[model samples]
Target: MSTIRWTEDHSRRSARWHSENHSPLPRRVVVADDRMRADHACRHAADGTALLWRGDFHNARQLLQAMGRRLDRRPPRPGSTPSESFDLHRRSRAHRAGILGKVLVLLEDDYTIALRRAPDVRLACQEAYGPPQGPVIVSLRELLGVIGARQWRVKGVDVPALDARIHPHYGVFSPVRGEYVDLVAHTPLPSTIEHRSVTTTAFDLGTGTGVLAAVLARRGVERVVATDISPRALACAKENIHRLALSGRIDVKGPCLFPEGRADLIVCNPPWLPARPTGPVEQGVYDPDSTMLNGFLTQLTAHLRPGGEGWLVLSDLAEHLGLRTRRQLLAAIHEAGLRVTDRVDTKPGHPRAQNTTDPLHAARSAEITSLWRLTSATWPPRASRHDPCAGAVRSALRRGPGSC
Candidate 1:
């Protein structure tokens, strides 16, 4: 019953087009060009062809449903994981490539909202896709996401920050991870505001929901600068900050990485696991061999004001999962010319931690979230950043996985 479909208004509707920006597609496809007779079109598509119906909008949707059900009825491969993820990922990808291989949409050169009752999605689409170049004929998924975001904006996330609501997008990483927030809010400080001159400046790196920055402000930090690279995340952060009435106090920017200037304190809640993300959403969960973590540590010394703390909220799940070691983690901190002054740990109470069905149930069950107080230091400085036996982090990209 869900209106879930991929759209590509600007993309070539033909499946044969193998373009770079576009995901890899099939070699050729057949467009139906007319109202489809279910059996006839199904048979033709079965022969490695597509049924691109130029008929009623609702009918096209109905036909897609039929095709999906038909596909679902087929038996799965032997030894398949039944959502086992590891192997299912491989099969799901292959299935996607094949089915999408046959899809072809019939559209005019300039894409337009021409359906009998298509919603007024012009503004939302423009925001996500930019001004349409000669009209963008896109996939159904993109269109739906745009319209969905519009609804979210009309409504909101009910933010206690602005005490209003911070609207979020469909795919944006929502502020569901609240454990870290509690850690930041409750953690003891290593040093009081010893500022000969109290600076209102603070920087929050990878401000996912701007929740931490909001927390910092709520804790009495004056001005906070938040930075993130993802547009969706940036939007969510801005919305949250503005809703909290901290727009005047907090500035959010799209920094490729860290922001400039010395901060009273810089905070980052990096991805906990040391693994590659399988999808766009997974980027928030998996750190891809801990690249982002290393980047923050490597750059922490430069951005932090003297005597300021770089608060790193991280989970020990990687260690619990036997993926990384604590010694290596401390070593990385040491190699970055920084030292952990203090750290406060918290246990996760999420249902997932107690769920035995999850593939990583054991690790998740034992996860420990902590806020590490970091200070720039030269103590135990690496003999060389790359010396393998030097006993710490390796090269920036290579420092994840094993040696922490």
Candidate 2:
């Protein structure tokens, strides 16, 4: 039996099974077997109950698919405000995902996951759950994700910005969303810095796979200091830099949010939303109360060299979702003592943006990603700064943080 917490209370409870889905604490969990009918199982799940399958592996998958079809035919709430409607849609999707993810699979005591047609996912599992000490139960749906992620880790994501593949670890954020990376690659370097003898250095805060850092290094930035709070992310970034033969140019550091000292340019792409993540994997997508984003803005000026620019890559989806507002963001920026000099905007061409059936489609369709070029309000530039694109490179080469 696995010891898990009952979310309602702080008490610990033991169960033979646990959910592997994104939800960490399911309110209701019930055990089921091969003898259980799919209709009965579906009804139980529809009532906000969790079904832990201990049945034929393939049958569990089929049951999950059946539940999915039912959810597709479910009607949307009518007569609700746009915000309420959007929230309802989000809830509906979350409910369906939770129900379908109940398909349970077993992990053998020897650290092997047994399921029909399942690929070898020991490495991926280790990356997530660590060495499987003994037999444990996990969600088959998540196992499938792990399997797919393993393939992604092997093949890597092709970054047009760097003209190279950035291999991401299982838990690290992948560079699948290329629009922001493209913005980073094309954004004009700030002109205030005199880029002459030594090359100007840049800082890439929250560098997950180091894609942006690699992009900066490729753009002739002499050095890049990539920082992250996760050791796993740091390791992943280092491996990618090494793979690209830019390890000598880009330095990976952390357990820290920002590298020590300052640089000519700093790039940060915080999680686009201000919401709580249910699990570690979701942290790259959802930020609680916009903590990381705010932290970057508040401390950015201190780390920027005189006349330096801080590139902030963000999306307006949260604003559309009503979770945040433009006024609130602008106020935060003002409070941080930073002012946006200019911004480059791009519309997302991802599949979700085109799917009208998606619950957040309205927001997704209207979503605009912008790279805000910002500078400290109090920092006086040595020279007049105007056209970011027409500036000549004349800065002395500087060593990045840690001088790797």
Candidate 3:
């Protein structure tokens, strides 16, 4: 086994040290030379080390992504059938995470935008990655995303409320899921102290970029505490809040679900789809169905004030994939000691929903995003119900668990 070492050299024009080949070390690093190799750069296991690349600035980035793909295609162990869904899912996720961690290498001072026929990504790079203090390098994959998102950010999805400007961070899921936000905005705040006195506090769980929190504040909620588990998301939310000048009304928190007190109204647009995301953006779009959603459901009762309802924003696309049945969801809610008081539904009007050429046409075409109003109730855990994947919705519904 070759020993790896980390050293800080002022001579290097890039930032961060990486190891390309430790059994436990990060598997790949982007050097000034642009070769994807297993090299160690950190001092004291990432204390001080730098990698330099030597390929076309654009291609260098593609290589990093290629390395990510390479890392993803690891062969399954012999005689180990990854068949049980939960177990397979766990293994796949662990493998993907390990590869993702390895793909992110260090950056240098003079950052080059890597891609085929790449353009000037300097501005975008500076915007997301920040200006390099000296000669340094960063994960080319991250840099490429910055450029792509920079372009996407420039051509932002118009937010009518905020003058139609939404600048998403480097790898955040863009604000394409506007339908749900619109639903929450339109849903009347159930008669609460916040509505009567205009001083009710609300919690926006998993507030990505504070979009929902900002919306809640705009909708007249006096105080909105936004909680997210991602530090980058927290920073992004803070920046957006400041940009919207709603800083006083919105407070951003990291990790914790509820802080100290219950809210008159708690709104959460947890991951709507039930699947693991392949990358960062997928995190916003997919949530392994019941993983995060289940957590939010079980804990919601403890955080909701008397007569205050928890607004759960969910999508029915999972039903299209035959992945989950409505009963499964309803049962979770009921089991959480919560009852659905009412529901407001919206049809997805995106292009893909009607695009005949899309792969997820079945789900997208018939997709519905709903805000289920949950109040206190007595729910019990029944035996698992028959799943909808067996082809008939009626049979599934008949045998399904009571979700409401």
Candidate 4:
């Protein structure tokens, strides 16, 4: 809990500082209002000074926009390689966010804004921050994001795969990209395994909004267990499962990746990019050092029953950006004692893919999202663990059916 202090009326007043990104508290703060010029505000922000808004709410918003326009006039320097370009773009974004975030606003004890003509944000604040503690100061940009998230929650995102809308929580990732969901929905479910009569059980790992788990259930997987490490994601998934009347067919579990027992099928859609996320919401898009991807592959075999399959829904965008390579991906699967059975690919239909002006547009346009069907290399009764032949058998199986 950090506090921010500013001088007003010849006295110093302080309020609790709230930053979701845990940014350092401003060292210097000054009262700013409608009379403040956007150019001066931009200069102060660049100098690392904070502006505590004491102006009309709408005017403050305009000031923020003005600052953004000024910053955008100067574009980031181009790099020689795709990877370098990506790095530069990320740094440019961070710089812009830092500058725009300098404009701050104060929320009263009960989550009310005292500014003139300010909209009632009590409900939105409560939804994002839980119970109001006391007077708190937050970046105007963050407060606007909170308000937008509330609207999104109220007007749920439509998912054609589920034929229903999924209302995403404040920090939970929304399934706005339907191509990945479609891949899961349309892919043929594995046939009856060795002794089982049908695909009776399934697991959806890191199930953000429970969208994939719900899709599995709707596809007639008798029992589906969804797991996530985020508390907010767990709660969001549970609520969605109940809303869709699939509670009987699905069980929401975990701060862990895998569940207690083996399942006939396991599914994972890890973060696409191998980079550190800037905030909670970005967790769905950026994965530091491909941690989640590697974790899923390494532990996937243990959680899968013999003759069962694991569906890894991933994108080649990282490869396009020069961050990862196809050979490395194949090597990972092989090292995990797993073999690729089949792969289904789809082009991204998101707007960014078509935006020619975006810095990473070339990579986005060339990206291919695939659902890789994998199975344990040593399945259906192989040599004993003590037998040296067992190692050879597993190695041979890795190159057997789907050698990439």
Question: What are the per-residue Cα lDDT tens digits for candidate 3 across 1-404?
Answer: 23223333444232344222122433333334444443232221233222434455665555555555665565333223212333454465555444434334334355553433546766776766566554333334445566787787666666655454666776566677667767776677867754455468899988877788888888888899999876667777888888889999999987766655888888888877676665666688778756778888898888877777789888887765666778788788878988776666667667778787544455577876777777777433121344322332322123322111
Which ranges in model 1 have alpha carbons more than 4 Å from their true place? 1-22, 32-112, 158-164, 169-171, 194-196, 276-280, 317-325, 349-362, 377-404
| TM-scores for every predicted model | 0.69, 0.84, 0.67, 0.92
lDDT of 3 at 217: 89
Q: lDDT values of the candidates?
A: 0.62, 0.75, 0.63, 0.88
Query: Sort by TM-score, best first: what order?
Result: 4, 2, 1, 3
Q: Write the per-residue lDDT of candidate 4 for residues 76-150, one digit (tens) a residue.
A: 887899999999999999999999999999999999999998989999999889899999999999999999988
Candidate 1 displacement at residue 24 in angstroms: 2.1
Q: Which stretches of candidate 4 lie over 4 Å from their true place?
A: 193-199, 380-404
Report how far residue 55 has shifted in candidate 1, in Å: 5.0
lDDT (Cα, 0-100) at 74 in candidate 3: 56
**Total clashing residue pairs per candidate?**
17, 10, 46, 0
Q: Measured by TM-score, how close is model 1 to the native structure? A: 0.69
Superposed on all Cα atoms, model 1 deviates from the true structure by an RMSD in Å of 8.8
Cα displacement (Å) at residue 179, model 2: 0.9
lDDT (Cα, tens digit) per residue for candidate 2, span 133-169: 7666666677767777778888999987787899988
Global lDDT of model 4: 0.88
C-alpha positional error of residue 231 in candidate 2 after TM-score superposition, expressed in Å: 3.3
